[model samples]
Target: MRKFWSKFKREDGQVMIIFAFAMVVLIGFAALVIDVGTVQVAKRRMQTAAEAAALAGAQDLPKTAEAISAANTVAKLNGGSLIRTTVKAPYQGNSNQIEVICTINVQYSFARILGFTDTDVSGRAVAQKNPQWAGEALPFLNLDDDYLANPKIVAWEKTAPGDFESLWPDDYNVYFGGKFDDHSKTYFTVDFADGITVTKGTVATVKQEIGYIYGQKKPVYIFSLSSAVIKSGKYNNIKNKDVVPLEDLVLLQVTFDSFDEQDKNLFLTTTKVFDINKGEYPTDYLTSPGGTSATIVE
Candidate 1:
């Protein structure tokens, strides 16, 4: 009898108790693995959606109403919703930056049995738009001091009448890469050589080619050739020229008046860019605001 009692005490009959505790711990580990993976997937999806939202918003910088509307639309399509947003025009000192926040609810499977059914997942993203962009240059002589009057197309002829004189295409070939007769605005831009110079006498050739369409917009980049106006490029010595340079860049809106095929002459009107730099309103807008590139900052 004493031996039986001693053996019973040694066994302790704790197998069921140990197994109950171990089962609880094992279920917790399984839940951690499975639920953690589910949450992570949700987080990744939300992050992508946030990124898309931020990019959409960045496209319309300074236009907060339009930016927010675009961001929300993209977020909904990407299986997430934007919770908060921030816009910084002239963001980070130069580029226009936009930040988007998004969130999602991840449902738990095995973790539901442990009293945790779902969790809220969130993500954030940021994007920036460059303030400066490159544009084709007029490659001509400066018109006047008046901001209203820009490049002088044929010695101060905003709208010239009578017979046109055929222009020498060789001088303008550097500015117009292809056939100019198409009259298509698509050919308005020309990529210049890195070291090319354009001053008053820089273009020694008289030019003509292609036909200019009336009212067609010939947007070009304008720069100050006067060292007095721009202190940075005083060494270039290229005065009385109209062109796009790295320094003192400005935006010019060029519009053609009329062209006579027989006369072989060109006429156009150009004005300062303040009216179109997203309007004349006070903002961090540069001379020209539309750029071709965008990037994700965060």
Candidate 2:
């Protein structure tokens, strides 16, 4: 019995057993760290996908079908599997908001030792399409005299200089005719229904077809209304001779009557009421429908 007891107290194999246990613990900790990091990466990827999809959808608000298509396309492009999406447009009375959720399956690199094959990660985002003051209206000055109700021949020929932006007519005009006496603040930008062809790129436009052109009368619900202190465009050096063909005029839209080359004036019929809200591009407008721009508010 004494001999057996002495043998039992021997340290043989004890160290190997302890070392094996320690190695197993250390490996477990290392594996856990790797798996956690991989999952975090997957979560970030999912978040990116969600945000991209939401923004894409928000741009096409009010149009349900178009918004859905845009969101799906962006999700696939960003490598996220879209789980679901909800959109709230102005018509739906949610202030035009959109939400996107995406997910991803992250395969565990080291956690497989623990029988954990993979984990699912997800992310979500929301966006909104807010109403903005449209700057894209025809070049009409706000008059307190209540003259819009009367069809007036607003002449820009002799009273106004052919203020050309060095000949590259901007898609919109922002010309300033001197100080606040400024009988009229020249601001024009709009998406007219027809009778005008707009080339976003610079096109050699004839002066006759541009600046002083006329067309049939149309109802302009959204007219331009700007304040006294807005950013002004420079038309200093351009002269009448400079208004020759080949000179570009990126005019937004101007169609009031048939091309009566004889009379170069805008005869417009208008309404007095408007939905006053936020203006686009740091605006102070009384009437400029395109004042608002697209942005994420969620």
Q: Which one wins on TM-score?
A: 2
State each candidate's clash count: 8, 26
TM agreement with the true structure for every prediction: 0.51, 0.55
Off by over 4 Å in 2: 1-13, 80-95, 139-168, 171-266, 270-298
* TM-score (C-alpha) between model 1 and the true structure: 0.51
Question: What tens digits encode model 1's per-residue C-alpha lDDT throughout 172-263?
Answer: 33322346433343222223322223333312232333343233344443322332333443333443222334333334454555554444
Number of clashes found in candidate 1: 8
Score each candidate by Cα lDDT: 0.51, 0.47
lDDT by residue (106-163, candidate 2, tens digit) is: 7887677768888778877777765554544543222111233343323223323432
For model 1, state the Cα shift of residue 129 in Å.
Answer: 1.6
lDDT top scorer = 1
